[model samples]
Target: MTEMTLDPRQLGTGGLFTAAVPDLASHEAAYGRRPSGWTRSPLLRELEASGLAGRGGAGFPAWRKLAAVGAGRPAVIANGAEGEPLSRKDTALLRQAPHLVLDGLVTAGEAVGASELFLYATAESLPGVGQALAERRDGPRVTLVEAPAAFISGEASAVVNALETGTALPRDKAARIARSGYQGRPTLLHNVETLAHLALVARYGAQWFRSAGTADDPGTRLYSLSGDVPAEWVVEAPGGASLRDVLRLGGAEPSSLAAVLVGGFHGAWVPAEAFDLPLTARGLARYGASPGAGVLLALARGRCGLQASAGIVRYLAESSARQCGPCMFGLPAMATVLERIAAGERAPWLASEAERLAGLVTGRGACHHPDGSARFVRSSLGVFKDEVRAHLAGACTAHHGRV
Candidate 1:
């Protein structure tokens, strides 16, 4: 794989999880620094100053989680569940930067006085994480858990629930996982990317971590670039890099994009005209999207946006845990309407019906599944206005809405 970095601000560092720096020793050499060791107070201070946010779609502050698991010998979980269908960055990080992730885990464990460190990773990704763990000589009492490869199973709460009871369903009411998680112990759970950034911050301090990105949200991110690309590639970029520049790393020029899915299934859509949008939290906030799971799926010029969203809606609906009424039922209904719209619905009312269904589904579920699906459905209807018009007129305008 040709590793291309779009950040352009090296900040006296090298590629994060690139193939050339394949393993632990190489990562150490590439980064050229490591934290001596971490203690709680100073570690929390530095992390707070770094202003790192969770990279697992939710942009929650890293310091908030680290600080919230207050004054206990809690547990730490490195989440590599890769539940989002459009995301592959976690697997790549497991394969290439596993040690850095583990180092961050160790640092976090030390800072929080964690007794056990658990890693939740997919079956395909477990081997990589296992290999990295085997090569490590020192760390906390670490355990390896094989995570189910389901979308919702990767939820932070679900991971803890799976570890505790062997049932991987998110809790109905979401509590602060940091304060109370995994056997009712104060736990520090974070995505693998966030942990990797923690390792950087632990070694380099907050300012060094802030050297590359914007002031409000500083540091780098790994984005899984899929769809309409020569090949799937993970691009490393600063917080606020332009969407156009990031997409180019996957061979997607702005002119080639019909519409881009800015976040994961729960994310919003941005028309090609909005290609100038940045990839940060604030940047995406302007467009009403977050860096959810760091997935940037670019739809090519000839693809039908309706068809793409319809399939995803159906998949998300099927993946639901079936615990929530609005999600389990409402989502399937919305998916049906999206499928109808995708199949060149001649009824002009179908669009309004979709809008109605999406509105009904939003905010009604116990989880964000319904909300995100509604966003995907609603955003597709807006971004693919031309396709919607064509479908109403009984035509697909482009490729008969295939894929």
Candidate 2:
């Protein structure tokens, strides 16, 4: 697998994982005491009231995913396999606030009738998890499974396949893993941060969880803010906070940016006009933006958006699992056209042809890889409309050179 080099830094003042060395006793003190007994059904109802959503990019409702856990021995897998190149909040949380994440894992495991809790993490994150696990004298049955660092390796299906089949590729089957996962039993999986919030929700109840952000997208979330910033920061803000506010928290001046990629590579592109929208799932949906994996990347002033996009597309092409024809063929084709357009090629069919290629591969692959790639391409086209026109007119606003 190819190694992606990116900054994995964090803010020292945030609520979670900002500590240099957070201990278990301090975690318990900050979040209040833990529960001795937990019932799955009641906890599910509480989660429904909390309006909590998954932090694993998709933002699916947490209560609903827990409800899908099948009858047999269930499992809770904490996904610390944060594979998005521009994201590093999970890594920071695992290293800094491990006990809180562990509280979440143990709490969630009991809520789902899970026989054991699985901690799936990239190899780089193991030492901290190991340190925390070693500190724990007693807890639920917890096991750590190290995963190879790759973009798709953190995906739910891929994580399952890695454990069951020893391959990090996503399963070709169409069924949801919540019903049949991890030893052919029901599984309750959550991103590392989301599970931490569950520990909060279990103690404070849903109303307390809903008190911070909007009613639709309640609670606070962590955002890995990078690209063109003086320093990278992992911020914890309310769910519906404006992108403008989040950017400021990340030490970015909104006026200085050409555009910002609200999500990671597989997410949307929003120009400054869309910056006013809230960073919530429902709010960003108004502008077709997904705060996927809570990544906020701003383009450097005068940096070529087209060139940057083409480079990202090429990375997506290189990272494909090659299971389906569309992912294997369509992505590389899209990247080629994108690189050409970024080079100030005066081809009229380039924009339309890029869209056509994206459509052919979208929603046609076994995993969401093709669909995500298409979203990235479609949003880039709209966000860089003026840039696209300039390229077609044989002029370059940023630079004509290749990425």
Candidate 3:
């Protein structure tokens, strides 16, 4: 496993050690509080005022989501089904700070007038989270559900489908799960970490929460910082911190990094020269990237970018749910182009084929698969222009294995 370094200044109070399970009695004594003062605190409003964004990939405003679900008979979902292969932040939170996550679920349920809470995780994640839920006596009104471990199956709609009918498959776009989820009720689905933040906001108040992050996007975010560092660890830092700061905090050598993949496979690629960029959604947008799912992969210079991208493309292609024509057909075609490019093949029609497939897939699928696949291939071509050129030139003989 590659080592990753995290900067201390960018980290939250407990930093990397925050996820370590503390003594239950001590944790309860310090964190456990009866559900009271709900109306007085105006927790949801305060969270909106504080500008707390979701720690999940999309960085959606937490308050906005709460307001969307408002005080009604809504359903709250803790999305622990982290489908990204390279990311483990959610799993770590579920395993270590399960109580905190549950607290957030309960708080969100209260704020949104949601009486029912559901905790959904991949089948592999069920045991740990289930045990954690069993240990808690007075938290949210939640039920644990185990979803299929397929990559796309962990998506929100897929989770909802699994919860409703025990089928871990994504529904058609026309039938968005949020509009009619879990027994036909309005639902507010959030990542487990997002709910945990809500619990903290409810307990500490939003001003304190806002004190750490940026002016626009407040509160901390958990990132699975991997590759080219001293330690591969999960780090929590305030939103909008400099990527440079995060790299340094993760003990990564600033100069050696060739590029950073800001989001997971679905995110854009940014060259190392852009490290000075802030880690907020707005900051990343300037670079045509978003920290989707908070995965930062550092690539070394000698590594072939085409090879790295080809591996991810293959993974995405294989992970396709095969529910739609575009995603089912287009991803494999894109994967073939990437593999050929990585292998130093200059098929005259490769570029155009990729573009055609990208066009065919974009926005045609029920999920973001088409868009994410397109972005992955498009960013690879743009960021790895030199590599694509080299492959066309037949210059590099070494093929770096999958990333």
Lowest-lDDT window of 10 residues in candidate 3? Answer: 3-12
Task: Give the TM-score comparing model 3 with the true structure, all chains together.
Answer: 0.90
Find the number of clashing residue pairs for candidate 2: 0
**Local distance difference test values of all predictions, in order:** 0.80, 0.81, 0.74
Quickly count the clashes in candidate 1. Answer: 2
**Candidate 2, overall lDDT?**
0.81
Question: Which scores higher on lDDT, 1 or 2?
Answer: 2
Q: Which runs of model 2 end up more than 4 angstroms from their true locations?
A: 1-15, 399-403
Candidate 1, lDDT over the whole model: 0.80
Q: Tens-digit lDDT track for model 3 on 1-403?
A: 2322242322222332453454446446656663555641387678777777776666788877766653347788989888887787777777656777777787777766786999987666667667766666656557888756667766777888888898877877666445577677778889888887777777777787787777866777777888666677677766788888777776678788788888888887888878888876678775568776788888877777778888999999999888898767889989988888788775656766777788888989887777888988888888887777768666653344222
On residues 356-395, what C-alpha lDDT tens digit does candidate 1 reach at each position?
9888988787667788888888788877888889888878
Candidates 1 and 2 compared: the better one by TM-score is 2
User: What ranges in model 1 sit over 4 Å off?
Assistant: 1-14, 17-23, 32-36, 397-403
What RMSD does each model have against the real structure?
A: 2.6, 4.0, 3.3
Each prediction's total of clashing residue pairs, residues at least 3 apart in sequence or on different chains, is 2, 0, 12
Top lDDT: which candidate number? 2
Model 3 segments more than 4 A misplaced: 1-20, 32-41, 70-72, 397-403
